[model samples]
Target: MWLPGNTGVYLPQDDTALLIDAMLLAPIPRGARVLDIGTGSGALARAAADCGAAEVTALDVSWRALAAAFVNTRLSGRRVRLRHGDIRKCLPGRHFDVVLANPPYVPCGRGAPGRHSPARAWDAGPDGRAVLDPLCDRAPGLLSPKGMMLMVHSTLCDPEKTLVRLRDGGLKAAVVARARCPFGPVMSSRADWLERAGLIEPGQRDEELVVIRADRTR
Candidate 1:
């Protein structure tokens, strides 16, 4: 976990841990093809490889994140193909039996706007769906039939919307795991904005993170 300071790479935090826990609990078929979206520190991808996935492709829009993942996965003695891109853009029409996601879901305020800033790892525009919505819209296509997707994000992004979108995409989706944790630095700074935007209540200091499992069961 030697993340370079000021590299704009996301550190493995609560959401990442939650997703890993959910992924481990799920029964990943032996020799399954797994794809880790926004691979960040590559933790989830490594876990998938260690858990029986024969092929694990970790994709991220930030090359820095991919670099972090490349180093981390190698350090863990896991073989994960690091891709410097995204699943939404079509990885040559590749489909995975398992897809892991820990995308940005925090509603970004004015302080964090630049695409290269560290906040890119957490900022998800006004409604926190800048990335989540797109991911939900395209996830079903990225998944193979009978495949399962494990995505972790904050409740601020409207889990109901995500569930509905996935279901609408012909996938069975549900919130499988949830955790209530205190607001981190980013959220702590956005408390006022979030309150004004009705994403959180006044004096609310904690946020709920949920692990949603969506299955493409044709």
Candidate 2:
């Protein structure tokens, strides 16, 4: 289905989403309980199914997106426990073997129209780690022992800073994948956002997006 300009789809372009799917597949074990946070396109939740996750819980703040995830999961012949709410407050109390998220990594005020826009999904706080901060903070309590948490982030968010945050939160984090592409309109170009956040020197270029794969400290 078409999600229109700036609305994060429950299913986005096949190539990028598929790559995320593959990334998630390798580490998740069969029949493990999994949580897919901000399941924009339900692509990652569905991937969890393919990975043999026994139960998948897909959470998002958008009722509209949850409806789409329900439909998409059915079409794939899989079932997911879907919830609609700000994940920060209403997360299920149970822990999971894995928690995967692709939170908004772009910093706020980078030309987003408002709070509810899909831009919200990509726009972090002033420094581009706002949304991710909470997720990592809560992960220690939410994850099962021996569990893993994988996220797709961007260099715009300062991969090192994110690593620091996750590490401080007790997850051993690392950059597992990265790719540089022509800038998209979703926000300021990575360079501009990075500069605005003081993450890079002026005139320095070569911006990139990244997917970080992190494991909970044993």
Candidate 3:
């Protein structure tokens, strides 16, 4: 799906496609409420809406991303609520039947990307858990009983950690899908730092992306 480009908005890539595949296979009921966190180009939001979700809300910290999403959603003729804010702060006391996230997961020596860099879309802290940890912590609270959360990230960040965190938060979690994709431009450029940091093996040029599914089973 082609979307309008913005200064800092992230374009849909392999990780986004992986999450969309998982979402399509998920057992989300018709007319379910869905939330997409860190919704860059609103691809997931639009996908959920196409899957017959009654309500779809997408949140992102980047204003550029929100604007792009708004345009994309409207162009697709889907009613997705786009909000610009931190996922942890906005929309309190609200829960959804499905929550999806494809957050920043690339290991970066300088931590998060600078304010104006498009790198903000993929550069996570050294351990690559900057956004993953927080998202796991908030998943249970944001999901309704019997709801499910599908999140995608690189294995470099430790998919087990995500499963453990969600399980500790009272959700049954497991890896439902995975894809081995060649390193994108961001990861390709940071290959040296990642190897030096012992996050990736020498000469490794691909990363495995995993989609973790966590269900709030009452």
Candidate 4:
């Protein structure tokens, strides 16, 4: 919540709130080990801790983001482990009872976000699957048997694609929540390009954000 100026850490937005809502409604088991991937302000991680999870691990690619997360979680009197690194490297053979994600889902144009740009928090490469695809591939392996994952992203990236990827990974996945949201500053700037790319209709200024729940039942 207290991200310092120019930190490039993501601020909690509609997508974050949406995911939290779904997470709160989920059936989190006792002694649940929850993993919050791409945690920005630690909002979701703290929310998971509020669920009385036995342990919460928040992973972020940006140290500044992790710093913000650490501060916020500590302020909430929650014991969330802050890890700095990409999930692909930070987590290997790791599993949790519940997994949460609100990764960058905005479709970017010719110039993708740099490592330090604030847009890095929201810009996914063309088609918006740069982050989502990897996350989907990793979700099944990240969940314990019968564990569940709740992820939120925009329809611009094709929610059905995510569902298929998760299902193919041996998980049952479906969209559980959706909210029509107006374009943000980034999207507004790229509206014309999105139109040209045929990803959105001309003059369409709103997109739907979806929360997908995936279960590893094996």
Candidate 5:
């Protein structure tokens, strides 16, 4: 996919690919209405469109990211509605058959990401639930009955917590896919701090990324 150069837009990475693979394996109904939250470069949105989704809405807080996604999706011959806004606030009252989220799960001491900056693409607060918590709480309300949400995050943030949150929200949730990825620059730089914060092992250099599938069975 074509991405903007140094435009503060997140380029697709291992997490994106993992999510795409899970999405492909999912039994998304044909012509499904799909929502791709935190769509960095529209990779997941394009994948959903290519997988035969009738309508795909891609949301990103970064305008640059949205522009990149728009370009990439259009280049792929997919019609995706690009929205520039936060996932928590955008498209109020909207529901979808499938919700795909590749949120920032990297544990950071920065508290929260700023409105602009590439760091916003992957810096979640300490324990990394800054975005994950809200997403889990909002997912069920955004999903139609029997709809499923596919979310990807790092184990550093506690995958079990995510599962419990989703289950408490009335979804049948489980880890559908997992990949052990070496520490990226951000994680590598913060390894010691993460260990000190008790978020990781003392010498841990790799983090496990898990793709969780939560089905709204109600």
Candidate 6:
């Protein structure tokens, strides 16, 4: 949905929104320092506040998206620190106890999200792991020593590869949950790997989704 001035994109669903639903399920510690990367619609940041996080900060490269997040925060009576920058280079000095991201996991293509999705949000290179890899790589540094991170992925991208990348980056990773729903923004090629990895049992399609959790190791 477009805001009044056409300055940003917005969506309202399940009261909390799509991105928020993913973050709300993350097991955040009470009074924890939290970071919501790619805070589209500001759902994650707002939900973090509702969950009693001691501090909440959200970052998105798009000014319009940031503005929308700010508005949503006020409307919901939730306080959050919002910033705009590339997720990797934006805030080098900030660290959080819990990092939540619902990055655009769809692989790069001419038709998807188009060529101008702020690069950081939907441009994940050939296998759609572009954004995911860097996020996983830098997650260790952005997180406090004992902090944990949670991210959402669809069957479209290489879900197992994402888990591997996170683990390889020194984080303890695991698939926390999975559900089936109508496909949104991924290619059909992802179906095979997901079933082969045991993430989706055989014969499950068109209605399954997955959530992954990774914990930073000391």
**Could you give me the TM-score of model 5 versus the true structure?**
0.95
Worst 10 residues of 6 by lDDT: 10-19
Instruction: Provide the RMSD of all predictions against the true structure, rounded to 1 decimal.
Output: 1.6, 3.3, 1.2, 1.5, 1.3, 5.1
**Tens-digit lDDT track of model 6 for 38-136:** 887787788889899999999887777888888888888889999878787878877899988877665554444543354445445546666777888
TM-score of each: 0.94, 0.82, 0.96, 0.94, 0.95, 0.78
List where candidate 2 sits over 4 angstroms from the true fold: 1-25, 110-116, 188-206
lDDT of 3 by residue, 144-218 (tens): 999999999999999999999999999999999999999988899989999999999999999999999999997
- Ranking the candidates on TM-score from highest down gives 3, 5, 4, 1, 2, 6
Leading candidate by TM-score: 3
Task: Tell me how far the alpha carbon of residue 39 in candidate 5 is from the true structure, in angstroms, after superposition.
Answer: 0.5
lDDT of each candidate versus the true structure = 0.87, 0.72, 0.90, 0.88, 0.90, 0.71
**Model 4: per-residue Cα lDDT over 1-218, one tens digit each:** 46665666777878888898888788577689999999988999999998889999999888778888998899888999988888776688888999999998888775776777678788888899888998898888899998999999999899999999999999999999999988877789989999999999989999999999999988
Off by over 4 Å in 3: 4-7
Q: How many clashes show up per model?
A: 0, 6, 0, 0, 0, 7
The digit string of per-residue lDDT tens for model 2 on 80-120 reads: 99988776787667788988888766666545446456555
Model 5 Cα lDDT, one tens digit per residue, 1-218: 57655766778888999999998898678999999999988899999999999999999888888889998999989999988888788789999999999998888876665677788988888778889999999999999888999999998888999999999998999999999999877789989999899888889999899999999997
Candidate 5, pairs of clashing residues: none
Candidate 6 positional error at 201, Å: 16
